[model samples]
Target: MAEASANIGVNFPPFLNSSSPTFLPSRTLKPEFPLTSKLKPNTWRTKPLNLTAFAPSSRLTSAAFTQTDDGKFQPRIEADNSRTGRVFFLDVNPLCYQGSKPSLRNFGRWVSIFFEEVSHSDPVIAVFDGEGGSEHRRLLLPSYKAHRIKFTRPPSSKRFTKGNFRTSYQVIRDALRSCNVPVVRVEGHEADDVIATLVEQVLQRGVRVVVASPDKDFKQLISEDIQLVMPLPELNRWSFYTLRHYLAQYNCDPCSDLSLRCIMGDEVDGVPGIQHVAPGFGRKTALKLLKKHGSLENLLSAAAIRTVGKPYAQDALTKYAEYLRTNYKVLALRRDVDVQFQDEWLVERDRRNDSTILSKFVENNDRNLLVQPSKQV
Candidate 1:
């Protein structure tokens, strides 16, 4: 994937200046959607976003951050403590496969709704999966995400072909650029790593962050300062996952999430679980071990002295120490990727609202119009 250029010649908001040390205070706006609600499993309401819901008066207000002379971002302080500035990191890869059929219409509509719901004052940055995004992971374990290719077959419908997927991605990229949302795709790097790096950078600045994607891999990054908003296609709504939610779901700290995945393995990514190699070892067993040992490394240390879990569990750990260690490397997200946060990537809410680019794209590529088959290119 190619790197997206910054929006040139656009004026930065006052708080966004590199030399400023404070963010402008803005009144807190209640989220239109529910932040925490219990719902039945596999039950999602699949309603399209109401475009008319975006009221003209709801424009984004304050700038995201101000930079100091030393090139470091200074955290914004609200005199009244109303709302801290927020920046959204949008992972664009999962959006491509959101609906039953993949098309530019599906992707574009979601993108529009996301920008519409986000506060105009906060910045939004889009991250795309770069070319060979999975190569590095594959090198760690050749089976990483290899199942996707192994199970790949020709799509039943031409509309769902790889070509259509690429077209949809391109159209969305163009639309985001036109609206002044920074679109980033670092070559040879996965968006997961890129987003992880960006999250780390922003956290150091003391700014709040929201990552928009349905990928569970991001769970490891959850914290008080950073939250995740996942799309619920079946419900046609977005769900928020915060540190509380992560704790409730995992019964463990976010830092231990990587170790949990390393032990349990990820079927979606084609990583084999300890169960595959050690019979009768499953999620419960993995969780128990993790809760006690805290991490795979610690568990291995105990196993070295034959003090970890039951005899069989200890035997498995000692026998497959190399395998478990490799899994950790495969599952851990990189925080040192060579991407930096740029002020130019901040969403210019006023310009975005005035632009007709996204609306036009949605109108032209409406889902109804994409049902018909297209000529093979």
Candidate 2:
């Protein structure tokens, strides 16, 4: 295990003060064990396995739930002073879609940047989009992600044919395998769902995760234990989107983000918003409704009881209840995907082989891949 310095701190809100045992301090504390120990053999249990090898220590703590004045018991997560393990989840689909011309070499450059600048010695798991990745979503709504195929299609260039895409993907996979990074692709499941399930699984072991992708759909997954790092091609860097950034931008909790998106449809995915289905329901209206009601379900319930302030908003909800529900189903990421975490996935990187692969992809002018500070979303 890497010795955590006292200076290293996690990004958590300062105002939350709790003395509960479940409250972990928002700082990196010293770990009692080393990072090189082998984990116990897996029994293929139904429940979450005790991944002590990945945790800071053997003891596991669950977030404490407290009853608020409103009679709701909400989970309270205070930063524990204990050391927290970190992992990076790289989404390969977005990386392939980046820039005007997608080059096989860019895959190597991106992975190299992550290890050299973002992850350092931390473990990374590269997730690729499985075959028929969007099939399940499209089954729910045939229009789901219908517009993305044309946008993601490789341009008519001799260097970027459909065959070349497959070749590039295989080369990148081989390179990552040689460097000891686990490349994951589940049959008929998108990388987003796989990453989501993996994030949930890893969080149970008290490990923090950084999801590397530019997709806004990942915003709903941001929390104290998880964050999204978006790529910025113009600046040649990556930026983080944390829980703090999400709250600042939406003026609501990250949990409500899905509901907000339900009301304001994703143009890229071809999902129609309530504004299109029911006029006068734009982003501002959706935000205001979400801030007051907290979620699409609650807003719909309020509308049913005729308690929602505006008559038009209530009518819109009542009329488009099924549509909104379908939207939620389409947008909500599945966390129940059957994906197991492997101890071997946390193995150390082969720096020599990694450097060799990176050198093959690097141009002479491309140097100094420093991590830039996160910009406001």
Write candidate 2's Cα lDDT for 208-273 as tens digits.
678888889988876656767777777666666655455456555566788988888887787888
> What do the candidate models score in CA lDDT, each in turn?
0.62, 0.61
lDDT for 211 (candidate 1): 86
Q: How accurate is candidate 1 locally (lDDT)?
A: 0.62
Clashes (candidate 1) = 11
lDDT of 2: 0.61
Can you write out model 1's per-residue Cα lDDT over 99-174, one digit (the tens) per residue?
4344556666666666655334456788987767788788889888764421012344645655544344566677
TM per candidate: 0.71, 0.73
